[model samples]
Target: MPTARPRLLYVTDLAYPARGRRYGDEDVFLTSRLRAEFDLALCHPGDAVSLMDAFDAVVVRNSGPVLTYPEAYAAFRERAAERGTPVFNPLTGRGDMAGKGYLTDLTAAGYPVIPTVDRAADLHRLPETGRYVVKPRLGADSAGLRTVTPDALRAVLAEGAATGADLLAQPHVDFVHEISFCFVDDAFQYALYAPRPDRRWELAPYRPTLADLAFARRFIDWNALPYGVQRVDACRTPDGGLLLVELEDLNPYLSLDALDDGTREAFVTAFTASLRRFLAV
Candidate 1:
C-alpha cells in the first residue's frame, strides 16, 4: 500500500523549553534516523491539523504538553478523528494520553498504583501520610500541582471538586529509585532508572530481570494498544517491589541519547518498523 518511501508528518515543538529535557534534540535525532526509511516533514503540534492530510501518517512525538495549546490540540484530535487519519500513537490510548483519571480508577481497582482519590468523600481512602501530592486530573508536566498536608486537603478538595476539576491526591511515595520501561507498539525496547531520586533526569541504563519485565508487561498488556509507543513509569518501593506511577501513553520523552549506541539503534529500528506497520493499516 506504500510506495518506495512513506510520507510522514512528524509533529513536534522544536522550541519547547522543557525544564530538564531537550525536546527538540531528541526529535531532531529521531527524525534524522527516520528519514532514512520515510519521507518526513516536521511541524509543530498546532499545525498538525493543517499539514496532516498530505502525509501517509502523522507521527506525534515530543510535541510538548497538550496543556500548552489545549484548544489547538483538541482541534487536531477532532480533525484527525473526523478524517480517520492514521496517528502513530493511535488516538485510542487509555493512559495519560486520555487523562490521569485512570489513576483513580486503577487505585479503586486495587492496582499497585500510588493510592489516588479525587472527591472529598474519597479523601478517607488515602493513607495517612505527612503530606500528599495533589494534581489536576487533566494536567501534564506538573502544572497546577501542589503538595499539601492532610489538614489542608479538605479545603483544597472543596474548591477543586466544585469546579468539576477532578483532582488526584496520593501520599508522597518514599522510593529507592524511579525506573521507566520504554515500549514501541507493546514491545519493550529498554529500561532506564534514576539512581538519585532527586535527579529525575540523570538516568542510566537498567537491565530488567524477568520479574521486572513481568511487572512492566502487565501494564502494557493491560493497555492493549496494538500500535503506538508507551512508557511504563514505576518506582521501587521501600519494601522491594515496583508500584505503577504513571502509564505514559501520550508524548513520552524518549531519552535515546542516554542509551548505548547499540540499544539506541535497536530502538530506532523497532520504532521505524512499528511506524511502517502502523501506517500500513
Candidate 2:
C-alpha cells in the first residue's frame, strides 16, 4: 500500500477581484501544483472554520481582505486557537495578518519602518510633509486609504477613534520605487520590484544586494514564524534607502505568474517542504 499524503485545507476566494493582481489565477496554479504532494481541498475563507478539522493543516492563500468577513475570520481564528490547529502562517504573525497596528509599533521601536501614528494627539511625531496618509488601522489592499492636508488630518484625528474608526496616519512617502522580498519561513526566496511607483503590479525580478537582504531579513527574523510564506515590502526613499512599507504574512498573493518557470517551481518546491514540516509539528 502507498503511504498516505497529508490532507490540506487550502483556503482561498477564487472570485476575489484584486486591483492590480490576479488572486484567482495564482491560487489555481498553486493548488494544481500542490495536488501532487498532498491530499488537497479548496474552500472559501468563510467555510474554513467548518471544514478545517478534517485536514492535517490549513494553508491560507489569497482569500481576500478579512475585512469583508471579519466575523467569520474572527471565528476561524478562535476555533484554530482552541484546537491549536497548525496554520501555515502560524497565527503568530505580527504583521498585516494581525492588523496594520504593527506599523505604529515598528515605528516606535525604531525599525526602518515608515513612521506611523495611531492617535490624533500624536500627529506631531510625523514628519513635516506636504500631505499625510490616513487609513483604517485594520485596512488591507489600500481599502479606506486616503490623503489629506495637515489641517484636514487634525480634524479627522480629533474625531477620536469613534467606535471602529481609529486610523493610522503617516507622512506621504515620495519613494523612488517599491520592492518586495519573498521568503519561506526565514529563508529568502526571491525579490521583485515595481520601477514606477504608480504601476504597482508591473513587477520585475530584482537582484538584491547584501544590504537589501539584510533589511528584508530584519522583519522576517522579527516575525519569527517557524514555517510559512511571508513578503516584506519596502520602498526606496528619496535618500536612496529602503524603509519597511508593509510586512505581509497572511494570505499574501504570490505573483507566481510574474516569475519564470524555474523560479516558480523553486517556490513551489520550497512551499511543499515547508508545509510538510508544519504538518509534522
What candidate 1 gets wrong by more than 4 Å, as runs, is none
**Tens-digit lDDT string for candidate 1 (113-139):** 889988888888988989989999889
RMSD of each: 1.1, 1.7
The per-candidate count of clashes, in order, stands at 0, 0
Q: Cα deviation of 177 in candidate 1 (Å)?
A: 1.1
Cα lDDT of model 2 by residue, 1-281, tens digit: 11278888999999998988988899889989889998889999999999998877888999999999999999999999998787888888999998999999999999999899999778888999999999988898898899999889988776647665878999999999999999998888999999999999899999999999999999999988888999999999999899999999998888887898888899999998998777876
- Residue 163 Cα positional deviation in candidate 1, in Å, after optimal superposition: 3.1
How big is the RMSD of model 1? 1.1
What's the TM for model 1? 0.97
Check candidate 1 and list the clashing pairs.
none
Estimate the TM-score for candidate 2.
Answer: 0.97
Cα lDDT listed for each candidate: 0.90, 0.90
